[model samples]
Target: MKSSVNQFSTQFEWILNVINVGVHIVNKDGDTVFYNKMMAHIDGLDREQVLGENIFQLYPSLTDESSTLHVALEKGIETIESIQTYVNLKEKKITSINSTYPLYEDGEIIGAVEIAKDITKVMSMYDQIVDLRSQLAETHKKNKFFEGTATYHFSDLIGSSPAFQEAISLAKKAARTHSPVMIYGPTGTGKELIAQSIHNVSAQRNQPFIAQNCAAVPKELMEGLLFGTTKGAFTGAMDRLGIFEQANGGTLFLDELNSLDLGLQAKLLRVLQEGEVRRVGGSKEQKINVKIIAAMNISPDEALERGIIRSDLFFRLNVVTIQMPSLLERKMDIPEIVNHFIQKFNKSFFSDVRGISQKAMQRLLQYSWPGNIRELGHAIELAFNVMDTGEVMIEEHHLPAYLFPSGKYSVSNAQSHHPPLKDKIDLPVVLEEMEREMIINMFEKYNGNISKTAEALNIKRQGLQYKLTKYGIEKVYAAGSKEPK
Candidate 1:
């Protein structure tokens, strides 16, 4: 009688425990030896229904081919957490993530126990978080500009004035459409920067972005540089691919468009219109899929009227025009530009120049900069050369003498400090000294190009010849001859 009472107590404990949601089980030959209420809740099977049923028959989704249970059974130590979606006996589909572990008895495999938590809500929340994170990433990417080649976007353009903002707005709109873009702006107004930003944000971001100044190449070589030439087209000519071909499926930023002679404008127009270019000394025309972004200070209409640019090409290039505002017009950004340049120069030159002074800032503001941002950059560089302290207290004296009262704006004042007769030397001798320095400097600047240096200083051939004689500058560099005295 005591044995029977003990057996009854053991049976009652097992039966009561099965009512709770967690399933405890051992199956031999696909028959459940133990069960829990949790397992019943997850699978929607009563303890009685699951007790003697084959595991695969009850959950048909967990087969040897497609189930984690099979892998655990095969490996004997594998655990798998998987989600299974199936229709219940009531025809309602249910999804449950089951974490199955293999059960062993007496160092021999018996079956597996699956602990499943209702992860539908968890999964739903996880998906929402992922979506929100993606949106946040996109927002962060959009807000961050100039961070790198990949991070730039249209929203990062900083400008408040209508003129500046309107140009950026048009650039943004232009980026969406795949068409030729012409940026009109004076030098150093960030034309190339704007072009790069546009290219970065455009659909062709992954493609090539090639920039070339039209004026930098010789006029006679323009055709060969733009369109490849066949072998033996010219002396020492080996078949070479031109820039246009290399920039296929990408952008080609032709800066200084006004510098290209009118003869080449017709050739450029053909490429824009027909999407084809015939190589110099080659008859075959090759189709090139390239987007153009031309930059020039001169207006297309003005160039067309002056016969500097072909009228047809002007129309083709003027499809979309973005006019970059001069830095003077956006004086509000001067401080920002100054700070940016200071940081940049500090890094580049390895100097500890912290910031510009209040007086220096005022000087920059009051000054009418003819050279624009380029001149400002140069001035900062010059200041670094003269700077002894960390503070860049750029006074008017720190500026180029030409930019001061002693330059083009010089006017005689009686009270002004005047040098004595010795200081006011002979004009001819002074002119000679100036000419010597200019010739020496310009020669170096032009890399010994007589025509280029002369053209740059806007002096005639005979005039340059006269100055060369007056200063006794060398006509042509003989290997060991003195350059200038």
Candidate 2:
């Protein structure tokens, strides 16, 4: 029986260690008895340093009142997804969503076990996004000239295509009134720009123009962000005005509305119908006067068919619907848009690249732009990065290889660059290969500096680290190893 118990213990330890989540087990006295590899990695502590150490001694930032493990063990209470920010043994601040439960022995709690998922990067991004709304609210009070600065206007948009103009015209008319407006289009078709342009010329021109992407924000945070959180709402929540209240008398643009949870969509519909917003945990509803601008990549009908969006809410937002045409639908406007991007980048990169060559323009025109205008802009920026400092024109070679016939994601294209992938036929696999190759090339360009490469790629260093791990590129590229982790 003793041997069987020991074998069970071994299997349990192995299973716990292999899982991705951090696991920390502590006794009633708050002394850590078990610390997994992932937990050590998360806390930046060695097992030898953490094991047998009291929770208070290990984490200076956590008090008995604040520590989930302590409360769970002492009070026999379970804490579910309680976000905690504490200083680890290494003195690095870490934020995690922790679920802690008291371990029971014959109905008496003897210890606590915590399962933690690191969300430091996610919290940082959430804070940045949420703080922007707070700052915008504060700025609205200070700056009487206008609300948060939204630069795009009807005239600034680069498109002469009839389909594009029709969308813009509808947006301009929407701006003239206070009715809710919805813009539907494919990704990278400048839906946000259109929303901003409408807000720029609207009655709420000087009011708050807050745009939140439904897909970008985490679901756990969506409710509190959209509807302000009261002080006692959650563990660390504070009294704050939601984006709706912040954009009072102005416009609040919710992009990718289909990505919003249906339940939240119902709440938003209530806000629109009642002309007020209720804080997530508050009792009173605060009256607000704000115009709503919503956008989605898919058509509303499709969203309804999929039940991703509430039908009642759609009617409230459908008063002014503008269908933004894809860039492919407006091929006649590509040359002008390409030139605009070239000029924009010349100033941004401080390079004197004059314009796109005829062959280069033809290369861009040849490919069906699956990613649309944003892809074109990215291609131009990449060209600026790859070209020499004094190069004058964006030549054919300066454009992305994917735009060329030889580098297309077809079987031939895959075989040319990746011989082993000659037999692979998956489009996603080919695209991933292209993405990895781009990262590798960017790393080479920047001498494997994580920061430089990530900056050039317009991604966070953590995101770059994730990609590196995904591709096992860091094993091959050692220069990035010297970077501060």
Candidate 3:
């Protein structure tokens, strides 16, 4: 009898230590018969403390309808997927994934056995990954839409002016050919949008359409970005393809061509002439099948005078030119553009604002838009946000003060007082006059702080002073004056 008891005790201890999941056994009357170390470890309880305790006494609700233990006994079959939370002897709460089934003897239900595993880490990781995937999906959607379209090609262009229509027609025609395309326009005239649209409409639409802003690229990184690099080509590099290689067999639109560094301009010229690119560190020149579409916000005449862009590259790109009209030159498109932005902002902001007030519409039309279509879009978005109710009625006062400044309003009011001058000036002379007046206005706005005014106007201080002298406005500053007056 002693020997038999010793063998049974040894077997039970061995089973307790080897089990991976928590294990518990209960008699047919729901009293605890055997509990293992794994069970105690999972529940954060002491094995000795759980001895002879009634299973239902600890968890009173363990009945046939709700508990797996009850179902196992009633059906005399294995019961799985029972979930329960337990408070260990130390009073700490822990969740367990519990499964129970009948402990059988030949064909009789002797008792029940339960198994559980801790799933806290698994559950936490699952939730985190799910959240990350959702965020990534949203970002991917945004990138896809923005990267696929350029300005004015789709309904987003929001204009139907004669100049705009002409530009689009020319762009569509040029897009059909594989020749290099050049787009000329003033700042904020949606040059990139036209470039992207041409690429999307072209035969190579399925291939990558890479759009790069030449002015925005850092001087040091420009070469590598345009041509690519081999493994360990530079610090922290892992063999990356350049923009030319990435946009192979598709359109590669380089914006602000005037801003390219002069030395790098030679390499670009070669690429245009040869249709091939050599990586920054590699000797082998790789052929690129990319279609080049270069854009400049400055006119060809101004570009020549500035000596910012190479003459050879200009000739290559100017084979086909698409001149995008500025908003000030196409006043007829303002209303349609305004309506489109209002509708777009409404959808994005979940606002019910139907449209703008008549006064607001007139105010938008009257303003001399410096930022063009982009500025108009921003103004509408700002108005929609500041409007009080769901139904936003944009008024003249709701517009940005910069659009209808006090001085500009006064000028409009005094317009009839000053009779129109009978001067049939050439385009160059008129542009010069406009430039002089703008500089004067900027000086006055800055309170004659030359440095601040120059910075605001995006011109060097010396450049501003030179212009002031050329226009004979330096006399105002030379008369021991601290201000422009």
Candidate order by TM-score, decreasing, is 2, 3, 1
Ranked candidates (lDDT, high to low):
2, 3, 1
Q: Please report how far candidate 3 places residue 158 from its true position, in Å.
A: 2.6
Minimum summed lDDT over a 10-residue window in model 3 is located at 417-426
- Global lDDT of each model? 0.63, 0.81, 0.70
Estimate, for each residue in 1-485, the C-alpha lDDT of model 3 and write its tens digit.
99999999999879876878888888887777888888887766777878787776655434446556766777776755444544555656555567788988988898999887765454344334334433443454456543432334544455778899999889889888899999998777888888888887888665666777776544555676788666645422336567787677678899888989987899999988998898887889898898899998778988987799888889988989989887888999888888888778768867777778887787888876655777677667666554555445676544544455563434333234222322321345334545755776777666677887789889888678767644434323323455442
**Candidate 1, poorest ten consecutive residues by summed lDDT:** 413-422
Across 168-219, the per-residue lDDT of candidate 1 in tens digits comes to: 8788787886898999876666677778778877877766666778876546
Model 2 C-alpha RMSD to native: 9.6
Candidate 3 error regions (>4 Å): 1-152, 235-237, 407-450, 454-485
Q: Give the CA lDDT, 0 to 100, for residue 65 in model 1.
A: 49
Q: Which stretches of model 2 miss by more than 4 angstroms?
A: 1-11, 27-31, 53-67, 70-78, 86-93, 102-111, 128-132, 349-354, 387-391, 408-485
TM-score (all chains, Cα) for each model: 0.53, 0.76, 0.57
Best by lDDT: 2
Q: Which model scores highest in TM-score?
A: 2
Query: What is the Cα-based lDDT of residue 47 in candidate 3?
Result: 72
